[model samples]
Target: MIFLNVALKNIYMFQDAKLDLSYPRKLPSSTVENEWLEDFPKINFKRVLILSGANASGKTVFGKVLCIINNYIAGSSINQSTSWLDIKKVMFDKKKPTSFKVEFLTPKTAQAHKLAVIFDQDGLIEESYTCIDLQRNEPQSAMYKRLREFEPTSYYHKTKNNHDITNAGFTSVAVSQGKMKVPSMWNYRLCEVDNTSGSQGRITAHDTNIIKTFLSAFDSSITKVKSIAAESYKIEFSNGEHVLIDKGKLLDPDRLSRGTHEAIDIAMFYEAMKNESFGESATFYLDEMLAYSHTEAEQSILNLLIDTLPRHSQLFYSTHNYDILDMNLPVHSHVFLKKDKYSEFIQPEKMGYNQNDRSLLGYVKNDVFGTLPSMDAINNL
Candidate 1:
């Protein structure tokens, strides 16, 4: 999705804005709420934020929350809808209905608030959120329209009074599924772009740029040059190897056996981030960013992202891989996640550890984040 469609003003619109697979140069010492200030580090970034957590540690939930906030700020009515009234029941709906709320930021126009889509476990959503001014607790219309513009039309088209897709406020914002969320055409589009240079109607031009830019960062041993004809994609290799995969094969771009191809894709993503012009104060998040690379290659990509990208873009990521951790990137960048018996996920900072400590992962493995059984219980036998 494009935000405030001001032509590259929002970095979150780019796929490369996914995640920065590096260590944090700095961490937020604390977070403040309701006149109480905690020692949370104030996180600042010229690049994207990276997040780490184990399965069900709530990392993805956190990302969705941020996107929801972004949408609320952009303006989409997601809170006033009736779908959230019976949250637990609807969330567990075997054939549940998705719940969404859209609130106009201002009563006079559609630009003051944002939209929220909450997914309930069994089926659709159970709760929705719309911006309630932090201070006034009221909605704004103009803001809602601004944020609405970034969401996919399919999401809002089902709602009443939201058919307008050309409003300037609606056109400026953009949002997409996080790295884990896949679109059907994702793979085909990658193969097509791998064979072609420009996006030119095949897909979003910026997305196409991101693909080419990411691929060029790999070692020359891997070649991504391709030719497109008859609505098909052809990927060529420098070693005289050729494989024609389906368009949808794009879902797992890094699943290929060759490290070079995986490296090339990761590099391309990094290059896109490095070369991005996403002005100041934009945010991006990618989930499980290290799936495709060797530790060394992941490290190379991280270095470029941290050192090379413009300081305007902020990034975040979620991953369970420790290869990224052992890379000696930085301590503050690492956020550990673990789950409790209650099925609740916790972060290192939440469990009373100095988030800035390099030993964070060590503690996580030892059940510091609640992943380990009690020592007494284990030794009882």
Candidate 2:
């Protein structure tokens, strides 16, 4: 499944906000080769999104929102709770419901699927799911809906669809077993790729080959990656040196830098993709992906993500690196989050800037986008 858009209200730093990744009605003239999905030509959809902002500007929180949505849709136990204590407290007498709506597409269905949920400090206030007929541009049908005060119902026309009401699970299993093919979702944060020695450490010969390919792209010196045993691997380098990884512990830590650990984490994702571990279509959420990496390595990884990720997959990343602004991504691919405020997309042309001029550094320096940090207080200190 491909993500189209996400809407949020009274959730953390967001207050009635919408982040639309769907292609603009009209593609910006600056769009170039390999920037968009080739199969979905009719729909203007971006496969890569970069969220950048100041230290406390909600970039990571926004990523967490997406993670929460994914978990809910996947029928994870995380969302079946009776109440939510993590909601943002309302400052005024009026309390707003913390809600979010996500829209996505399934490969087998012609309609777009939507899931919306509203909750408060006490519990879930409302939840609903519907399908929209893209061809007719109308609400096609209501799959399932539940209001806090009313009994939940699964509707098909006037009658309830018993098959749809099976309390087994929601979108996750239904999409996989049903006609629609839901997209797989993966989330990565700092240390997850480096320090965590989870299932990712287990590898097959094919997986090792795939990891080698990505590692080679990032560092050609990595001649081979071989799984010696469970949770252990051997990496041979071009300089006739070898390093061993035993149950997530790396021998000779000085040889494999933090950047390599990050790269290995990414390579494991590639291995998963090759093994069809994430399903047909996938969405990857990476937070602070460039941490501890130098400029050249960052650029190399960025290019790797751009060129290597499966065509059907979408990558959403949050970073503080200003160098990314120089990558010349289409305007629609950028989202700027302001602290305690709303997030907005930056359109290069609308701001009277040339896309090819690499003016993002200048724009941020001039505070054109308003996401830059105010360092005046630091100077005073």
Candidate 3:
């Protein structure tokens, strides 16, 4: 399952923001072969999303919100998704309901699902769900025309003093179909690469080679990586000295440079994705853990990840590196995010950039879309 679109109102920093993953209708779909399923070519979704923006410009917040929605759909959403969110922005004080509208496509079922929810401080208040069919041989025009006219199947609202949201995830009609075809049938894996000093992961023997090879590419001093225990390994250097990672803890982590430290974390991430059983359910959300790695190395791995994505999977990557704008990615594949009074996800293709010959990097560097850093405070200081 891939999310085609997500809209938020009164959720954390978002006042009214929408992130649409579907490819633009105005642009030709000729270069987006990797963007859609082979059987469902009419649904041109944006498979690879390279989110680049200024600092604190709502990049990380967007991913966290999406993860919360994913968790809520799976019926395991925790309060932590909004635990640290701003209470004022959440509208709890104003007694308004935070709302979300999601549209996703399940390739296996050859159908699409749109789920809308509204909840207040008391808990969930209302929910609505709708399902649509997409035949394999359906014409593009017919499919899009039906999409615009999709009517909601059901919408429910709670009466006064009804606050228990535990029995609620989807409406009654949505779950009546035996949980297989409903939104809950499928699950997604949304992981953010947190590469702090004390990060942990079990690295067994089978993954030793892949880990070693990827790390060695960044640092030439390492000779071999041997699994000394169930979750421990010794990264030996050519200088007869070595580093120890026991039970997933990198002891003496400061011995390595910052770049080498990032490499270790990325090695684990790469190994996991390389061997993952990706399908409709496995989605990836990667924040920039390559702050210390070389640009070329990052680009190579980025390309590899895009090339290896299964037909039904999607990758949402976030970064502040302006160098990434120079990559050969399509304008539609990139979204420039910025903050004014409210956060917005600006699509380059929709910003009147229908022509593919323009330089996205140049436009961004010139602050054309207002994604560059605002210097009002700095200038005053």
State candidate 2's TM-score: 0.72
lDDT of 1 by residue, 1-381 (tens): 112111110112111122212122233442111111011122122233345655555565445434433433333322323422122332223343333333322211212233434332322222222332222322223323444565433343323433354221221122321211111110110211222111211322223334444444444433654535332334555777655434423334443455445544444445444433333224455555556556665666666655644333345556566666555443444555343432232334334554443555576566555554345765887
After TM-score superposition, the amount by which residue 217's alpha carbon in candidate 1 deviates from its true location, in angstroms, is: 7.6
- For model 1, state the Cα shift of residue 11 in Å: 26
TM-score of 3: 0.83
Model 2 misses residue 148 by how many Å? 21
How far does residue 361 in candidate 2 sit from its true spot (Å)? 2.7
Q: Which ten residues in a row have the lowest lDDT in candidate 1?
A: 180-189
The reply for model 3, stretches above 4 Å from the true place, is 25-33, 80-94, 139-154, 160-206
The deviation in Å at residue 354 for candidate 3 is 3.1
TM-score of each: 0.47, 0.72, 0.83
lDDT of each: 0.37, 0.59, 0.67
TM-score order of candidates, top first: 3, 2, 1
lDDT of 2 by residue, 111-218 (tens): 466666665554444555666445432221221121122332222211234345334322233343443334445544433323211132233444677667766766
Q: Which stretches of candidate 1 lie over 4 Å from their true place?
A: 1-49, 76-221, 227-234, 244-255, 258-268, 271-277, 327-330, 341-352, 355-357, 372-381
* Better candidate number, 1 or 3, judged by lDDT: 3
Candidate 3 per-residue lDDT, tens place, 1-381, comes to 788888988876678888888874535544434576678766678878888888777777777667666656555433543443222344523567788888887877788777887776645577777777887867655665676568766555676422343444323323443332533222122224332110122224347887688778888888899989876889999999989988766898887777677776666655545543333444566677676778888887777767766567677788777777777677788897788877888998887874665568888888889999888999999
> Quick one: ranking by lDDT, best first?
3, 2, 1
